[model samples]
Target: MTAPATSSGIPVSRIDPYTDASILDPYHDYRALRDAGPVVRLDQYDLWAVARYDEVYEALHDHEAFLSGEGVGITEQLNKAQHGSSLTSDPPYHDTVRGLVSRHLTPKALREFHTYIQDWADRLVDELVERGEFDAVTDFGQAFPLALVPDLLGWPVDEGRERLLDWAAAGFNAFGPLNDRTRAGFPLLAEMGAFLHRMSVPGNLRPGSWGAELVADAQAGKIADELLPALLGDFLAPSMDTSVSALSSMLWLLGSHPGQWELLRQDHGLISNAFNEIVRLESPLRGFTRLLARDRSLGGADLAAGSRVLLLYGSANRDERHWKSPAEFDITRSNAAEHLGFGHGIHGCVGQALSRLEGHSLLNALLSKVRRIEVGEPVWRLHNTIRGIESLPVVLRA
Candidate 1:
């Protein structure tokens, strides 16, 4: 890759982050991005990237300067398409929309699912432990959320459960530039969006469920009718893969480092900490784009108005400037929770509590049934914005 300078004099790298190779293992490129400068211009995408923790964290919080309303993707077209989705809206508006969506997933609201999710995880782990081998992603990681999210939202098992995982993956893929991966998913995403819109009706949702609440809110004018579909999409789209990838990465981290797994098995309480560490080490949603709302100077570069800035969460979490030995996955690390793996600020992951509940519950269940988790070659699924193990071969010691 060649290093060139943009017209504004920001250091440029020819690395295309959306490419398959980069998505597979982005650390090398991440290190290069941070080392080159705080703001590295990606000539391939014509966007400036903020890879260091300081800048990324600042940009995440400073929604005024780095706006999400234009869309949080590399391509301008996605910004146009996803204009007012909770993920794409700015504050005031973002706060209102997010509040309406978050009412159902709040800690108190999700507490009911703790036992159910734990029971599900335990049952799944019991089967894996009995068999002695299983694919972690299919059998455990993705399986947990793929089954739970739709049910929690009260979608009909036959209608929505089967398609939840694919729709979530495709939704995230559309966040990137118009690459082959994004291109292939566009049609699927469109179809899924239409389905979600149609099924978002009150009668289609289970009574007293999250989906029902959202539909009721729309009917009562808590949020506009037009925004209901996007809000419901918000509840579904980002939840699946983000949790799947996080859980899968957590399993991979634990299985690969037997000592950590042993630590988790012994304490059980550290399951939450372990989840944080895993995401800190392998952030699921790699990075998101922010349009420069105004011309501003950051890290010695003068960013012009309307320019796209990539906030590298994966890079930021592993940045040496923020953490000591940032690359090492240490579950007991004191400040691991401070990582930007789930992002930072007001726009930080609203569903984080639910994700933690699912991960922690599953880990707790595994500790009770399995003594050791032996992992084989893990297969990575490449999406522009999400990093996940598609298949994780593992043998559990009962």
Candidate 2:
């Protein structure tokens, strides 16, 4: 692998994952990486970054060329060692666990939850509207998803929402590094693990909820009992961060952009399209490393085998090559789904339909109540990986 040198002729700084400035505000770093050439090696992390739009898209589409089982997480060594999580696995075995996951998460199954999603959204909006002021993150973002996911997954409703929230936080935290990101994540992960362990036992998930159905799937020789913990853990771990953060990002954009907010406020019919536009502008995950399957040419760069590659979804969405005026956040972008926020290919997000449902439900409810999401100064949560707001205060305009 060629040593990575920045445009300034200095090698990139690979420091403790938590403190690396490039990882902090990666947009600038993405510009440098993408322009430095197709596959610039990062001397710091010793990883190759594919910051250009075309390369990341090609890599995702040609999984046979890039290969995911090696791990989508940063470390090449870790990617190689991974077994059977839907987020990491590639094919064959990946399809098995993913198929089991799909049995309950299918579009029909997802639609089954729309009434529940809208109910939660409406109830929360009603409560917050009555007060006329609320913390968007805690009062609504965290509450709505936390309220619905456990019930939908068939976890016992008792303190499950709080537990699920903690676990989900830790799970995303673990994705970044071993410092505050990974270390602070243990308790939430443990709580989620314990809760999921109980859920995995006999008679937990409702006979229909996928989590419960997994137990039956296990009995029917579909999924092994040993993998049930990880399967359920995947739910608590990956489900909330994107949904919560994505919704937070949407609120931040619509509230901050009065025109955009009013467009939705006017029609309410554009809720789904507006949600897609928001995600296109500000995706939740920044970029993470992937290992190259073999030495190959990608997006005008020579990508070598065994080198770690950075898949910069956030940066790529803004690439000028594919998007006309990519940086513009027009809610009217014709093909908002063209953005890689949900990713592409087999390893792409499986829960995207549910994520969309949450957005649709939330937006529909918000349009009914808020004439506009009055903006307050926003606070960003700095995860090494997830791009999201931690707290966004809003004034509800009825």
Candidate 3:
């Protein structure tokens, strides 16, 4: 590893964040990046990195300085691929499209599905408990959202729904730099696009579902017809993968740290805060890049216009400056909600409300039904962006 000095005086490291090794166990690299400085240039990727919590938070909130419209991915190809979508666009237009997608996801809007989601969670946990041992990732984490989100979004039940997880994971993989993993995802992304296009037609989607609403919006001349696929994707990909990562991590974390599980079980009120702690410790999306719109001073480093900087949510969540014992998983942490796992500011996750609902419902159900959560080692998934478990053998003692 070489450290190169730049005119801005920023420390440069040769760390490759997308490597299979790095993706599998990134905490050491995250610590190195944070310890280096507030801003460190990744000489390997020719990108700047903001690993400290203060800097990441500031940059995430200052959309004008750290532009998303140019693309949040590391490579130009991936960024251009996302052009015009809410993820890559600046406000006004970003606000319009996000509003349409978020209308159904708001806390008040989702209240109608409260009982339904809780009931589903109860049933799913009950089945898993009866089985005694099952793959927590597939049987529980993936199962919960896969069962509910598509139905709410109006995806046809028979249209290769089994592949939704693969498609969703691929969509996120495409956000990374052009590695083999990223390249493999393009075809899957296109397939998802094609599927969304087919479902965009008036009669193809469930009439009253969220997907149908987007289709109707496009038909009514409210949004461009071309944007329909991206709009539906805004709901589909993120609503699945990130939630699965959080849910699966929830189980792994609770199981490994029986003390935390007992703490949560004893105080049912800690359910919401526990979810926050889980994502804070293990952020699903590691980080995303932002193109500097203009030259600016960040953390005393002079960043130039057109420079692409990676705001590391995962690193920031574990930054020692902001978090006391940042590496420790304590559900009672007072400021746990401040973590940037779901992002911050305007581009903050649109589906976070629903994600929280799902997490809360599941935890509540588990508390009522299971006394102990025993687990085997987690088989972590290797991908460019999402940090998730592929499988975990688990036993739920009642």
| Local distance difference test scores for all models | 0.84, 0.72, 0.89
On lDDT, the candidate that comes out on top is 3
For residues 138-183, write the lDDT of model 2, one tens digit per residue. 8767776677777767877665666676666666656454566666
Q: Candidate 3: deviation at residue 195, Å? A: 0.9
lDDT comparing candidate 2 with the true structure: 0.72
Question: TM-score for model 3?
Answer: 0.98
Candidate 1 lDDT, tens digit per residue, 1-398? 63877777778888777778898889998988898888998877888899999889888878899998888988887778886577899988998888887877788988877788888888988888888777878887877787778877888767867777888888888888888988899878887888778877779988987888888888888788877888888888667888988888877888899998888877877877788999999898898989988998887889999899999999999899889999888999998898898788877887888898888888888888888888998888888989788898888888
Clashes of each: 0, 3, 0
lDDT of 3 by residue, 175-291 (tens): 787888878877888888889889877899999889998899998998998888888888887789999999999999999999999999899999989999999999988988899
- Clash number for candidate 1: 0
List where candidate 1 sits over 4 angstroms from the true fold.
none
Q: Which candidate gets the maximum TM-score versus the true structure?
A: 3
Q: In candidate 1, where is summed lDDT lowest over 10 consecutive residues?
A: 1-10
The regions of model 3 sitting more than 4 angstroms off are: none
In angstroms, give how far residue 351 of model 2 lies from its true place.
Answer: 1.3
